[model samples]
Target: MDTYHKFAAFADLDVERFKHFQEEREALSTLKAVEIDTDADTRLTALTADVKAFKTANDNDIKQLKQQINASTKTYQRLSPFYEQRIALLDQSEAVIVQDDDLYDEITRTKTTQLNADRLDDWRNRTMVLHHQLNKAHEQAKLKEEAERAREKALIRRRVALQQRRQQASLKRQRINETKAYRDRFDNLVVRVRNRVDTLDFKVIDAPIEVINAAEAVAAQAFIFTTLKHTDSFTTLQKSLRDTDAKKIATQVQKAATSLWQQLERLPDNQDKVEVLTKINERFDHVPAITIDGATLTQTVTEHLQKTKNAIQAHEQAQTRRYSSPRPF
Candidate 1:
């Protein structure tokens, strides 16, 4: 009985004050029409700031209502099982209620307010949520400070990168021009060298000595008929002439040197006393050409250049082997 009486007193909390506030709100609404003796200039201004602030707070409160609703929904779901129990319990408690006086009035008022509070809780939560959204909009509207800071940083980076790109482009242009000039000069030198080689000329002359010349013509005729089957013929030719080591040379080179020596050895001059001009012309040609190709190409240039380089290397290697004999022959 004491616990029931305490709950009744709690349920009526702020009832008198809440009533006073409600009555004042009604009076304020009717004041203009009733022509109350209120000063025109001294009229109250609208509470914009207070209303907005309160609305924001209310919206936040309402937005959080889903959790409470979910809880209540769960309770309502479970309420069925407990419904008969609750009704039975309330009946038993109502009998106990008749055993008190002041407790009855307080209990009735408490029940009335408690029911209303329970019903309006969801609405309050919704109001709080709307209030918070309004506050967020207000914050977003006042973004001048952040925008200014971002603009400053962005401009600084833009200028730095622009200057860097300009310098890089200028350096690239300079390098390209320098390379073109170097290539132009090299091309000019090659053209002059080619012109000189194209003008070079040579003529075949009778072997510089009479005896060597006559004997060479006869041996040349003999070589035309020779089948190259003579194994000792090669050895005999090497022994009869100025060549000390003919066997070590390439086949073509050995044949050419042997042919030249065979003609010279059969000359009418002293075979033992070797002459100077006869030895010098052996395995040698006087007129040499500048051997660089002068052809031009657009896209097919690389392959042509590779083939030309390979050919030049082979030609030089042949010259090295032909002239580099360890003997005077």
Candidate 2:
């Protein structure tokens, strides 16, 4: 009966140990669904090591207990269920450990995949930003090149315009010089003609016919010049030449009137003188009215002729009275 009570106490002790192992396995199983972190990984490793230690210890204890149970067939038969229970608890513990290990491995793989995906996204974003910057730089460079080309074209155009302006200015200066030379030559010719006209003697009666012809020739030449240019200077030269010709004509009329008066004074008979004077007056009638020194030459000739006629008549009357009065002898 004492041996029976000892075996019963051992069986109760083994049952309590089995209950403790089940509680430990239940705790390990709870870790299977824990949130993954450094602390969780450490806890899983510690739990896995603890489970291995417990399993090894349980295996040794079971081996020793089996040896002790085989030494007594009665103890073996009585503790068989407890041995099976321990084996089942070890198997359940191993399964729990395997589940926790799988959970940890899955969590680790998921974290590594997420890290690789984040790296890829970062690389792509950086590449896109770099590409955008390169494109912007290229566009700016293109714009700068276009602006430079435009400026170069503008500069070239300005240079061409400046060259053309310079050419035009040079041509204008040359034309002005040519015009001035022409004007100078014309002025010199006019001056020489005026000098020649100034030297003529138009007031003298016996002014040589050759001189008169020369004067006329000079006036014709001056007229030709006037027709060519027709400036104020040429107009003045023409007027001077005309005045010279008029003065020469007036001198000729005065000389003719003086010669007629001399011929009438030399006549012996009044009738002869009358006839001569009548012929002279008839000839003078055809003469043109000409002015000399502000008086008309035809009017002066008429007054002189009238005075000569009166003197001749008076002399004739005196001669007649002498012949009619008793001879002074």
TM values, all candidates: 0.20, 0.27
Cα deviation in Å at residue 64, candidate 2? Answer: 46
Candidate-wise lDDT, in order = 0.42, 0.52
Highest lDDT among the candidates is held by which one? 2
Cα lDDT of model 2 by residue, 95-115, tens digit: 332334543243234432133
- Candidate 1 lDDT over 142-224, as tens digits, reads 57657877888899889888988988888777656655654454356446533432332112333445434332332222222
In model 2, state the lDDT of residue 249.
36
- Displacement of the residue 71 alpha carbon in candidate 2, Å: 57
Model 1 gets an lDDT of: 0.42
